[model samples]
Target: MLKFTLKRLGYMLVVLFIVVTITFFLVHSIPGDPITAMVQDLPEETRTVYLARYGFDQPLGVQYVRFIKACLCGNLGESLRYPGRKVIDIVRNYAPVSGVIGGLSLAIGFTIGILCGILAALNRNKWPDKLIMVIAILGTTIPTFVTAAVLQYLLTVTWPIFPTTGWGQAKHIVLPVLCMCVGPVATYARYMRSSVLDTVNQDYILTAEAKGVSQFRIVTRHIFRNSFLPCITMICSSIAGIFSGSFIIESIFAIPGLGKYFISAINDRDYSVVLGLNIIFTGIYILAMLLCDILMALTDPRIRYSNDR
Candidate 1:
């Protein structure tokens, strides 16, 4: 176990380095003059100063070496568009809003999804099951941006049932959070339904029924636990994505979350913000995968990492 964990940690570092290196080169290689774009309004002397200070005047190799060093030392550098503001600081400020949205969406989505899934499974081919399946298909097939647009149009533009956009107040996040959770609702419902169905056919379940076990006791005691493991596996595997805010959802709602700022940073060529956030996200995903594997092994004795004695 220790050996596996060490190997995974080593891989994480390598992946993080690759992400940083790629983001650095890609952002720098973008079309047009980033320096001029950033300091277009400044005087020539100030522009030169800004260029030198930020290594905009340096060769790519030199800039890359310096950037790597800064990253190693936990300095993510300042935002190019907003001078003197650290990328880390920006993440700290905006990440919570995204976390809140993601957390709420997952909580609500998972609950509703699981309940509907259990309902569908119980009903089998009845109307409720068929209707839920249709909803699940549509929800999963539809893009988040499309969902956001339609909701925004109907709830805000047409009916004024909710605030048009922007964050603050409970009502503000309703649409975006709902939109973000659509995928989860579809995903969980489908997976749980399948899982429940499969569990229902297991020999233990048949034996329980033959032994005169009540339906509710059989389902709640045996099937629910077995059926939910796969869902946990999915959640563990996708933990990193939980905080990524589904990209454009925040923007559609005009929320000042990390994902929305990330979009702006890319458009404005704010190298520090873009690179830092990307690396952070990459690290999160890699680490989450490692944790997921470890968790699976711990939770299921049937699982093994290697041939170690």
Candidate 2:
């Protein structure tokens, strides 16, 4: 396990290097200089001084190397648009908001999805199953922004049950959470239903039944355990999906989160913030994948570490 973890860490580092390099070059290649954008209001002499102060007068390669070095030294560079604030400071302030919303949505979605799936599986070919299927289809088909807008209209605008925008109190989170939950819940339900159905039909399940094992024991202890493993992998991979969903939901709801910062960075062409946020998110994703692999090995004895396998 140690060796396997080390290998994965090495791979993650390599990927991070590639991502950083690509992002730096690509952002630099974008039309219109950030220095020009930042200094547009300044006189020509003042603009030249500002550019020199920020080292914008340096060659692109030198700038890239300095940026990489600064990042390595725990400095994500000062934001061009926001001047005195470091990119890292902005990220630190916003990440927690996104984390809270994303984490709550994921938990609620997964729990509801698993319960619904189990019920649908148990009631296959019946109305309950059909109803769940329709819900799953709708959840998967609708775009997240569309769902956010519609929910805002129905729950916030028309009925005024929830606040329309801005995140401060818990009340502000309700609509965004619901919107983020839609696709994940639907996807998880369908996956869980299929897994349960397949597990229930396995030969071991039949043998357990023939031996007169309690139905509850057979289903929960044996079948559910095996059935839920794949869902774990699916859930981990969906971390990226959850974050992406939060981007739209957060922006629409005016939540002060990484999503809002990300959108602002793009619009303002704040490359430091954009690159900093991207790297942070990519680190999170990689860490989640590693955790998923560890959890899989721990849960199923059959899943041996690479050395053991």
RMSD of each: 3.5, 2.5
lDDT of 1 by residue, 250-304 (tens): 7778888888788888888787788888877787778788887776665555565
Of the candidates shown, which would achieve the greatest TM-score relative to the real structure?
2
The digit string of per-residue lDDT tens for model 2 on 210-307 reads 99999889978888888889998987867764453366777789888877778888888787778787777787788888888877877777875444
Question: What does candidate 1 score in Cα RMSD to the true structure?
Answer: 3.5
- Which residues of candidate 2, in runs, are more than 4 Å off? 37-47, 157-160, 241-245, 305-309
TM-score of each prediction? 0.81, 0.88
State the lDDT at 198 in candidate 2.
96
Candidate 1 stretches greater than 4 Å from native:
1-11, 28-33, 36-51, 57-59, 149-161, 210-212, 236-238, 304-309
